[model samples]
Target: MIKHNIGLTSAEIGGLWEAFFQETMSVCLLKYFLHHIKDEEIKIVLTKALDFSHLNIKKIKEIYSKENIPLPDGFSEKDIDLSAPPLFNEPFALSYVYIMSRMGMINYAFITANIARSDILSFFTNALAQVTELYTDATTMMLSKGIYDRPPKISYPKKIEYIQKKSYISGFIGQKRTLNAVELTEIFFNIERNYFSILFCLGLIQVVKDKEIKNFIKDGKRISEKQINFFNEILQKEDFLGIISVSMEVTDSTISPFSDKLVMSLFHFLNSIDITLIGHALSMSMRADLSTFYSKVIGEILLYAESGFSIMVNRGWLEKPPQATNRKNLESR
Candidate 1:
């Protein structure tokens, strides 16, 4: 039970870069293993992925050593059966990659900022650039083959600004004239994050494979579910306010941002979104006109954000950091 402290570390940032590769391999291999029955091309693809995973694993090990951080017992042959059929198929596999690459980019942007130390922060900046490049390459592959699931782009706005498809996702709220697109985005974004937390935690439990990883994932799942329901309750309270007439909706239909990595990517994206919403809450809280309940909910979300990051580490989705860096990040401001 890692006492899940707060804040960003260089190692964790690097670790996520490595984790993305690990997860990418996991999905690619899982899909090929299940469906490669007699297809030479799919087998070739699986072999190439296995090679990439092998190389990336070595690189990650080097990163851990460089940071003077111990690598947790990560995945191995014992955790999977090459002879066994894959639990996932092609459609889902592609979806997972597409969304997650976008999600990975978003998180790296945070890791770059959230990590204040020089060397550690540089590690993330470098990783972010590399991951961006990786994403671009993957996107090219998907585009060439016509398998990528692009994100929902908000079309260009005309009359009032750069608004696009957000209109469908948003609606007019009541009394408060200030509850425009930004406010509407906050509401639905918060709801989607809650939903993502629930689903990501659940998806993690399914393929954790290792004993420590599996138990950790299950524990995180429970925590995430509680937080999701908490957010849902808070949004319901917001409905009681005169801010807007539009009702909040948490649509469970998850969209694929990456070809196959939607689940993991959405999980990562939602975690980042929670942080953004917390910032919004804080800014709103400082206002003289904001309600007391909104401020309280902001306080609650702050703690829940800490918990969310903790669960990510516990599940091995987020890498643990070096003690020195960890201590500094957790220390009082």
Candidate 2:
């Protein structure tokens, strides 16, 4: 039903549709965070995030209106209770903002990279800037609050050197080479992200009341812990310290601050991103063992994603995405 001259492309529509739904969920979660957050500094960061989410939702609505497309029924105030007890402590909430902001930057960058339309491109560029600032502010706050776990410091190279041996990429035999900087960066980044996922899952498991969903989240936590230890063992083998855990940052809370749908959606999103990142790491990995391990882990995560989708579908929580017309059905008719 779109016009040829000025109508939005499918890519633009998909990007905006996904963004609108995510921003709506972000608004609801941030609103709850703002309500229960006691630290003024962290509160300020959450407020900024909430403001951006609200603005994105408004802009997306405008685009839909122009295109004569119906808006998605994303999360709203009805999906959250502001008066509920705090499910996550301030430090955990701060970490949540930091992690979510980082993901937001990745998403906006991806959307902007493929965009063609002038308005859509500009919208995502502005969104990228906002999320970058939000990430900066959240990380600064986490550091000031002493909740950030920085990567292990490596010594400066005595001098720039080029690869001189094939062993640099070998892993299936004798005299395997030590980890390179690129591989180490990817491993550490993965470990740190999975660490965050563990804590996030732990908090969610404690509060989510649905037995099935709670068990699914527990599987997520277990997977994260498994991955965390596997990656950490890699660094520890080199006598190098790894990023420590932040699971203790989560407080004991049985009350749910977010709806089950929001919690699962967040889990689904995080796991999906992890799959993408793991694929990148696998592609860059030179060691045969590491590459094989990443491939197996990816399969595991895909299964996990399938389970999450099932939960969402059974509960009638999953939103239907736009799809191409079924020409076969038309022909049969």
TM-score of each: 0.45, 0.94
Predicted candidate 2 versus true structure: per-residue lDDT over 178-294, tens digit per residue: 787778888888888888887778777888888999999999888888888888888888888867866446667788878888888888788878898899899999887688889
**For each predicted model, how many residue pairs clash, with residues at least 3 apart or on different chains?**
24, 0
Cα lDDT of candidate 1 equals: 0.47
Report the number of the highest-TM-score candidate: 2
Model 2 residue 8 CA deviation in Å: 1.3
lDDT of 1 at 97: 40
Deviation in Å, model 2, residue 166 alpha carbon: 3.7
